[model samples]
Target: MCVMSRRGRFQRGEGRHLCNLSGPPSGGSASPGSFLPLRGIDLKKGGRVKKPGRKALVSKDPYLRLLVKTYKTLARRTSSAFNRTVLKRLLMPRRFKAPISLSKLIKHMKGRENTTAVVVGTVTGTLLYRDMMMYVSTESRRSSDSAGEDDLRVNEVPKLSVCALRITRTAQARLLKAGGEVLTFDELVARSPTGSKCTLLRGATKAREAEKHFGKAPGTPGSSTKPYVRSKGRKFEKARGRRKSCGFKV
Candidate 1:
């Protein structure tokens, strides 16, 4: 038998065979002159990148989901830019499509005869204008007798077709009473897929009081932004911003 060390070799019939090592083989590190190996992560641009949120809606309401699904299909099938716009608005947050008042609708839809007014959000009632009061008086006898006089001069409210996500009870009843129609968004989609003969309207986004305080600082020169103060008085923010005597007038 031949003496064996780290490697055990035996000669049998003029052929030499080596014994296999029990543990793992070692001592195969790269030399100093050899190129360094690159890691998987380092080979790629792996940092987080900023991007816009998903455009599609994830509403829990079944009806809204159904509407979104329908609109998505329609938007994919049809090339109408109007449908595309409606889909985008439908996916937007409720604040973006704030509720619109009937008075605003009347004002905007003026002279657009036989056209459907579409609102993506709720449709609310307005303080009855003199003209609308007359229309409301005839249909709703609950009004005071002074409102219903045959000989009295009154303005006539124009008949209109309104489409909205929701309509307040008062606005709905008034519209129906005035021979005007109240339509759901689905109905509008069915009636005018391409938004033909329709006038799309949105609420005044800047009308909110909170929006007043959103510009430059209250005391900044030439800045008309509103400030959030407890009260408006001489002791309040009226010193530096209001008069040149205190420090400097804005």
Candidate 2:
């Protein structure tokens, strides 16, 4: 029977054998140096081997699965890097396919006119309410009521063509109002198989709230990482390393 040595190397009964919980094989005793190989692993290699890239989609959504299937075919048939990238992104989980706002998309597409903007994720409509209010207040302060209204109209979204996995209702309404075109992956494939004149965009991956506490520990000198705390009040995570009065501050 095979055994493991102190250093974790497999041995031919040189070390303590595994308990004979089920006794030997039904036919006869196991050979002295024999070892059962693990499925999908090579004992000679000492570890499991796997192919790179996702083998299959993990999501059960029918629409998402269909999109992946289409992209997979495109990636295999076409030599376009865009198709390959889209296929890879399609296979990713929801978190990695971050949601982007329309404002950010307009900003990125500023100088690239008459090209399709492609995103392998959802497109959100507007900024948060607080930000929207702030924007309106600032615009109102800049000019008279009539002039401000005209300025707002002039700053309208340009005619654009966008393709994404999903789009929020407000975003779609805004796009349609501006005479822009919203497209799906299949439609985009039919239009431009090689992805010519298409610009790829993605949301900020580190913009998630959970990412705020991922860097250096909170209270560490020169570290801006946020601490996971229940509250910001005086009683919660505000003493010791957080304040100079309670022991030395970091």
Candidate 3:
């Protein structure tokens, strides 16, 4: 028969549900009851069946119960540790989720390369630029009294056309509003007018200055001279300082 106590429900982390007392009161000589409130701990209809690591005692104190749980967890981890078999398993992390598959991507790429005969192809067509440099590789064959004199020849790689990347007007406006000043030549091509964009080499060195032309001067423009007779009030104040008013001070 299940026998639960009235005084059980130790605050969590207290005794790890370990009671200082033993099983049901019926298991003992007396009636199954306790010194505490009769709510919360439901006996298995009759009472809660005693499960593994079931409640043993109850207390409100925190530090005392924390002590018991820490020791148990420490002991479990330290036991049977540091052997070769255990070490290998511990070093490798156990994963629960499968990784994303890239094989399909590789297959698609291979199919594309076969069709185009190039490793990679871009959707945007290529663009050409002027003033770009090409290096000439000069190779000389030094014949040590042998296969005649093979003269030096210059070999150059094919002239590569550089594509200028562009930024949208909305993007440029947003960037400018965000206080972004620096932009590459390609970036300027996207947002700026052709002339302005071409002028900038690599990054934005020149910021467009705000215009200062105005229709009118800020403050009073017509007279530009001080108004007269303002000192009359000061003279009146001086005259009143000596004169007496008809009041109770008399």
Each model's lDDT comes to: 0.73, 0.79, 0.28
List clashing residue pairs in candidate 3.
Answer: 18-57, 19-56, 19-57, 43-47, 43-48, 44-47, 44-48, 167-190
Off by over 4 Å in 1: 1-54, 130-155
For 1-250, candidate 2 gives per-residue lDDT tens digits of: 3445568776554223353223457888777544544223124544456677786899999998998898788889988899889889889887889989988898899988699999999999874243344345565546756553433422467778999989999889878888999999889989998899999999988889999989988887889998988889868987788778989788
TM-score of model 3 (CA atoms): 0.12
Off by over 4 Å in 3: 1-49, 52-57, 80-250
Candidate 2 deviant stretches above 4 angstroms: 1-53, 127-154
Residue pairs clashing in model 2 are: none
Which model scores highest in lDDT?
2
Using TM-score as the yardstick, the better of models 1 and 3 is: 1
Ten-residue region with minimum lDDT total, candidate 1: 35-44
| Weakest ten-residue segment in model 2 by summed lDDT | 13-22
lDDT (10s digit) by residue, model 3, range 1-250? 2223447543422222233344446655644364333223433345555654323214344542442343233335555221222222222222211121122222233323222111110112112122332432333234522556322231111211111123345333332443433243233224432222122112111221221222333223342222333465645433322335622121
Clashes of each: 0, 0, 8
